[model samples]
Target: MKKLFFLSVLLFGIFSFSQTLSSTLNKTTLALGEPAVLKINIENLQGKDVKSAPKNELLPFHLEETKDEIIKKQNNYTREIEFAVFEEGKFQIPALDFKIGENTYKTIPYEIEVINTAKKGDKISDIMNNKEVKLGLKDYWQLYKFYVLGAIALIALFIIIYYFIRYSKREKNTPKVISNKTLKDLELLKKKKYIENGNYRLFYVELLEITRNFISTQYRIPANVLLTDDLIDFMKQNNTISQENEKVVEDIFLRGDLVKFAKTFPDKETMGADFNDIKDFVKRSSKDIEFENIRSDV
Candidate 1:
């Protein structure tokens, strides 16, 4: 009776101790040069700090420590380590040793299979001599030379006729230059009573978009998508807009942003001043258009 009781107590202690440390592999199979994870979970650490295992070069694996997390409720500590296998074979990860409060414990070893992705004993030379194929127009050219020439000539004639028709239609339908379009759009926008109707937001939005579109068309700077500062930077970098004219454009954009985003209302005088400034900017920037207008009038 006394021996039976002692054996039961001893077995229980061993079982509890065995449950304290455990290790697992995320995947047992891997391809060469691919990484796998090794998880070491230690329970009932009792607030003792633990140190990771030292890397061993003799093993068939390369080990790297990735993460260590602590679970306060369960008194558990988890260490995540990464392992990469370079050689293709079946191997076992050696037991990883951990130290806690002058006591050393080791995790169970895990077996893994590393597969080779490359073909064995295969070389470019092995395939180079196995097959030979000849391809060219020379072999069939003599038999169908006249037919081929006729087809090519027809294709050439069709292309010439197609381009001639396209050119004639384009000449008849080509719209006026961008400057003329911008001027007409501005004139139409000015006819709207957006400011008088308390639609300052709409007024500024249209104003800014029109100016940005003009800049995009004239300078090709994509000003429509760029903010005021970015537009200024682009212009400065390219030296496209003169410094004085750049300040005028910046002022207009700033006021427009305030009206559009901040809901600020500007007086009629201010609106009129900005409107004239835009017109002046367009005229000065598009000298070629102004010259053409002058020539047409003369």
Candidate 2:
């Protein structure tokens, strides 16, 4: 009875192996040089491990490459397989056989066909017997636009560079106005021997005009409208003159006031101090001032 039971168990295992471990390829036709994918699905396998195909009369095309994916479901395994074919001909993919425990199973042979490729344009040997033709204006303009755009970009680059250089040079060469020199030029006129000798009053008038001209250059305010009090107020408001310089400036205004209205005659030292004061005022104020919109009267 135990011998009979063992024989039944062996027969059942062999039947299970024969049902599983089967594979198949999908397509059988392909163009020459074109790729053909062969999918081999193995179902209800006991163990995954598949053996390499035998090198016999089968597989006239190159194997190229093979890829496999395994999936486990409940109590069985399935292997999804891919094989590539590269050569041209009718070919047979060889049978794949594998053993599960004491029993083995094998796949049937699959057939495939590879066709030739179609030619494009014309054969080069045939074209060697033909002649060339000339191209038209449409083709000429298409090529011309590329060169035209390149030339425009170059001209724009040169214009930008030239303008920047010219502007920089103009700024560097511009001259600043000297406010203190205008006042100093006035004082120097007063110090001349001619003022003390014959025209003392004329000296005072000239000194006044020099002070007004200094104000014009330094402040850009018209000098003709400014009186002694107006000059003092302007200097105070603008912070242009220092306390010491304002005092000297005021003294010159006071001296000019006496000469213009009261007709007073100051001694040479007194007169000379006022003259020096004008020189000092112009010297200090000129450095900080600019003459705007002034064309050279000279």
Candidate 3:
């Protein structure tokens, strides 16, 4: 009786540990393109320490397999299969074979529905048309804006440089003042009637300006800013003027200063002689200057 009872218990335990598999779905019905996760649970593998199992390569109809996550325990394994269904219909997922060790397990079939949300029941809606993006100035500017701006900037820079060169050449060809031009200036000053009006101070002032302008241009000196004595000293130091010219300059400068500052008035005869003396000096100095505008004083 003890042996028979032990045999019955062993058979019952073997029956209790039989292979089992079940399939479930996270969603029953879903919109087209939506995901449906199907889970498969397996238990009680026949071989405890088996080496490997056959690969089950079959997938459900009309369902795209997105992912398959498997969880393995001591005696069971669970698989979560994520799928995206595009076709609109009811689908019965057929039973799949799961070969674990030596024994094969089967999962119960599942049913899921997929619907098209773009249309109502039995009424087809107009599908969206393809759109063509029209390109405008702003869009084209975004593509080539750097090259356009750089070209404009370069052109402006070249224009500025060109004008600057032209201006420089013009200035280089022209002189501000020249000794030969003093004759024309002196003639204009004489036309002012400064001496005839008994304005000896004004006359001397105008005459001295013409003299200074001539000296500054001819000798490349800032004679307009120099005192009369300083000017004479600089000329003497540099031996730029002859003795006769120096004497004439000293006499005219000293007398001109007296007339301007001390209110000393000169007669018409002395003024005329002083004016002729200045003309003589200019004529004598410009003889060898190779000036373009100088005319012989008859």
TM-score of each: 0.39, 0.37, 0.39
Error of 2 at 218 (Å): 1.2
Please write out the lDDT profile of model 3 over residues 176-245, one tens digit for every residue: 4354488889999899998788778889999999999887776555789999999888878865555666
Residue pairs in steric clash, candidate 1? none
Lowest summed lDDT over 10 consecutive residues: which window, candidate 1? 56-65
- What is the per-residue lDDT of model 1 for residues 48-90, given as tens digits with 9 covering 90 to 100? 7776644433234354333334343336777666658777788
Best by lDDT: 3
lDDT tens readout by residue for model 2, 1-298: 9999999999998786643555656677877655555444445554555444442312444755455555555336455555555666787776666555455666677777876666677555664666786778887879798898889999999998999899777555332234535645764685577446855577778887877776665565555787788878887776655567678777887778887775788777777777777776666663333322232332
TM-score quality measure for candidate 1: 0.39
TM-score of 2: 0.37
Q: What is the C-alpha RMSD of each candidate to the true structure, in Å?
A: 20.2, 17.7, 21.3
Which residue pairs collide in model 2, if any?
180-282, 180-283
